[model samples]
Target: MLQLASGSSLLAIAVDRFLRVRIPVTYKSTVTQKRSWMVVAICWFTAALLSFIPMFGWHNYNTWNGTTQANSTSFECRFFTASSRSYVVNFIFFGFFLPLLAVMTGLYCYIFLTTRRQLRLNIGAATESHTYYQKEQRLAASLVLVLGLFVVCWLPLFLMQTIKLYGPKIEVSSLFVHIGVLLSHVNLAVNPIVYAFRIPKIKEEFKKLYMRVYHDGQQH
Candidate 1:
């Protein structure tokens, strides 16, 4: 669920950025507040729908061929144990991650190139264009940072899932999955810190706190 939400939000931001660069005039009118809310609702609905599918008889315990469980002993719940392997391979990897990632990457790349070209032209509204391009450049850079961090934090888990699904079953596979899970959790923590440092108001407060802490440490 966390992954679906984060990936969806990132994809939304990338698409928004692409549109803002590609169609400045129509972008404002097209991306209205009401429509934005609609997108949010759609994301939530899709996440809920996909996650719930496992419960409706598409699970490892009761999916595809037959009961995969060898022992009848009830164990601690795990994703692979509960969710269908077919679901993980088909939807999670190929359906969601691959397509979403491909689109977002293409959009960001287009935005980067367009912004650069606009700067090179610099024909009309010199000051305004300069400011706009600079702002766009900063935004592009920030988006890259955010997206890169997201991939860094989340890729391991997905890769591990892929290996777990396809690769030969081994003892170390469990360790890799555990490490991947830990890394995914790290992303949840890192995103807030990254955003907080980027926001003007929050960044200013952070600086103030840092200075105060430094003074307190020096005095002691």
Candidate 2:
């Protein structure tokens, strides 16, 4: 549920950035500060409701039998291992795939429209628009990189899970599942660096910090 809400929030930001660039006047009126907060609130509410529903008897876990127990611990709990394939399928679609698809679509569409607009600008407007367009292009490229990283990190996990659920029965090694999960987690670590490198202000701050550390080392 948290994942769903986070993805939705990111998607909203991407869409908002695109609209601000493409249709500034209309976007100002339609996506006001209050409206943006409202969108976030809605995402949170929806995620909470979906997540809470599973707690009300949808989730199935393996039952412990004394003879069949893997360990002597009586408090052991294993979730998502039961015969409830439907729950897994629904989680994949709603929690990951749908939100990812929406974000990717919005980002690519924004890139396309920005490129078209750049190409169509008149000579008279070129000088006035050159700096603005350049900045937009940089930001868009950064976002594209971020989106690519997101796909790379999550796609394998998503695909493997989907296959495990829907494909022919086969033994899937725990090592393979662990690797996929690790790759998915790598995104959380990489995102901040991606943003810092892409944004001019953040990049500048990074440079300043680097220089400060370098100078202090030299003095010592």
Candidate 3:
């Protein structure tokens, strides 16, 4: 539920950014703070509702063999696989893929159209537009990279789930499963790094902080 909510929020941000760049006048008038908050509230509510449904026995966690073992400790804890293949399919399609597709489409289309419009301007106007366009390009590129990393990190698990649903029964190695799980978490770590590097203001603040820490250490 938390993951779904977070993904939805990211998608909303992408949409907001797209609107601001592509249709600034309309966005300014329509996408006010109150409306944005309302959208966020709806996303959270929907996420919570979807998550709650599984608790009513729509899904089962006891299907995996490792979970049935009595001696398993916290370190040996394995994630629960859904008992129903349909549940997995529904989750992947609606929860991850659809939202991802929406965000990618909005972001990339905005980038393409915005870039094209900028290109069509006179050379003098183009030079004047460069700074603002560059900023938007950086933001779009950062979001795209984030989305790419998200897909890369989650693709293995998604593929594994799909294979389990359709392919012949074969024992998947625990090592591979663990690696996929680790990769999924790498996005969390990479997000901050991406933002810090791509945003000029953030980069400047980081440099200032680093210099301050270094100077303080020298003084001490």
Candidate 4:
């Protein structure tokens, strides 16, 4: 699941970069495809390494069979009830929410900087050609939408986990915890689909990639 999430995140970033800066006629040919590939590779490697922490001893994990008044799911991803409450709260706060917040913040920052530059240069109006200005707004809107959905879906799970940790006195319903996990994992897949279908250039790239594979199969 972590590996898949990482790949989807990287692909989203690549698609975002292509839309915002690289795919414009002015910049597309000059920015080598290899550079984009490298960026994707780095995202994958970094996610893979970071995700190994829970699997390895950095994040706490354990099997819980204790019976409580309000049942939580047997399978908890963020933190185990058996672990230190403070540590669990910190993990949920910093490990998941903080990073997500940072990424979204960065995206907004990029959008802000891009808009400021365009305004300063007096290129705010749409040119006859497809310039970065024309597409960046729509792309930024889409990214904001995507990230908004991500935060909405995943934030609940983190909040629930944090509540369970900090406010241990309050019992959470098992069904709610399970639902949270479902939402978070669902986020892992949504971004890629949005890019492949919603974004025109990305859809074209996929079409070309598919055609190349199909032609190669026919040749063989």
Candidate 5:
């Protein structure tokens, strides 16, 4: 659910940026704060809806005619174990991941290209054009870095889950699972780094928090 939410929320940002680039004149009017919040809310709600489908017994009905047991005795609940093969293998990887990847990639690429072309047209005519272009590129770089990190980190876990869902019962190392989980979580750390560079308020608060934590540790 967290991954789903993250991906969807990022997609909203991509869409917002796309609107900003493709329609600058109308961007502010269309992409208002209320609308932004609405989009985020919709993304989270949709993510939760899709993520909880397995829990709501959608996974009980398999791809075939087989019906899964409603109850289990297992203490440790793994996603691959709890989820249906269809949900784990097909829907998440194919339906969500691939489509989201394609859409976000397309949007960011379009935004970069469009802005670059526009800047080039105004190169000598506008003195501030270079500065604005650099700003756009920096923002684009950060956005891509965050998205790329998410993809790189989560791909391994999804692949592992797919293999576990379909492949023969082979004892895989828990270490590998833990590593995959760690990588997926590491994607989250990129957000703070990007925010620190982009938003001064957040950067100030982060510095304060770090100093407070370090002082407390030293006192102990």
Candidate 6:
């Protein structure tokens, strides 16, 4: 659900960026504004659908084929049964891993471009050229730093999942899953903190929100 929600939000931001660059004049118009919001709504709806299908048992949880274990944890419904392990493995790999990999790949590409631009600007600055290169460099660095934090925070969970999938058949305890999931959940909250504290626009917005609430409370 977090993946779907956060993914949709990120997708909206990307789409907004694309629209701003591709059709700025149209982006400002009422029609375009309505259409943009419609697109966002569709994306969120689709995300919810993706999350609900497996959850609501259009594809039911897998159980060990024709076998009931006496000593095993029968209370826990085995979502990935021994018989369906291969299918579940593939699903996890392609569904989650592939998309995560793709996102990281894109992040790397962005980092590369940002680094290259910063380096070029720094070289120009060293040569005593009059350029707004320093400001651009700072902006680029900030973006890269945020992206790097995202990668750092998420990579550990991905690595843990991948190892459990393909490596040794060590029994995955609930504790491990809980820890990994907690770490992953922290990323969602951490991202907003980073944006609010480190990004000027977000910081200003935070201040406005804080002041608005404080003033409203005082008036009451």
Best-matching candidate per TM-score: 1
User: Which digits, one per residue and each the tens of the lDDT, describe model 1 over residues 107-175?
Assistant: 988888888888878856567766776687788788788889888877777776776667747334566
Clashes (candidate 4): 0
Per-prediction TM-score to the true structure, in the order listed: 0.78, 0.71, 0.74, 0.66, 0.75, 0.61
Better of 2 and 6 by lDDT: 2
| Candidate 1: worst-modelled 10 consecutive residues by lDDT | 70-79
Kindly list the per-residue Cα lDDT of model 6 for residues 1-220, writing each as its tens digit: 5555655555455444434334535657734767877877887787677666555443424433335454475655332333233333455445754575566446545544654565675674554322333443344455445556655665655565566768768666766656665666787788788777766888999999999999999999
**lDDT: the better of candidates 4 and 6:** 4
Which 10 successive residues of model 4 have the least lDDT summed? 60-69
TM-score of structure candidate 4:
0.66
Point out where model 6 deviates above 4 Å.
Answer: 11-39, 58-93, 100-104, 107-141, 162-168, 172-174
The Cα error of candidate 1 at residue 82, in Å, is: 1.8
What C-alpha lDDT do the candidate models reach, one value each? 0.77, 0.68, 0.69, 0.63, 0.78, 0.56
Global fold similarity of model 5 (TM-score): 0.75
Q: What lDDT would candidate 6 get against the real structure?
A: 0.56
RMSD of each: 6.3, 5.6, 4.5, 5.9, 5.5, 6.3
- Estimate the TM-score for candidate 6: 0.61
All candidates in order of TM-score, best leading: 1, 5, 3, 2, 4, 6
The list of candidate 4 runs beyond 4 A from truth reads 1-31, 59-89, 109-113, 116-130, 208-220
Per-residue error for 74 in candidate 1, Å, reads: 13
Among these predictions, the greatest lDDT belongs to: 5
By summed lDDT, the worst window of 10 consecutive residues in model 3 runs over 77-86
Better of 2 and 6 by TM-score: 2
- The model with the greater TM-score, 3 or 4, is 3
Candidate 3, residues 117-139, lDDT tens digits: the string is 77566335646466566667667
**What's the lDDT for candidate 1?**
0.77
lDDT of 4 by residue, 1-220 (tens): 3633543464456356545553456466555689767766776776666555455554334333334323465444443444444443475456655665676567566765765576557665556433646567666666666767777777787788788877889999878888887887787777678777767888899899999999999999
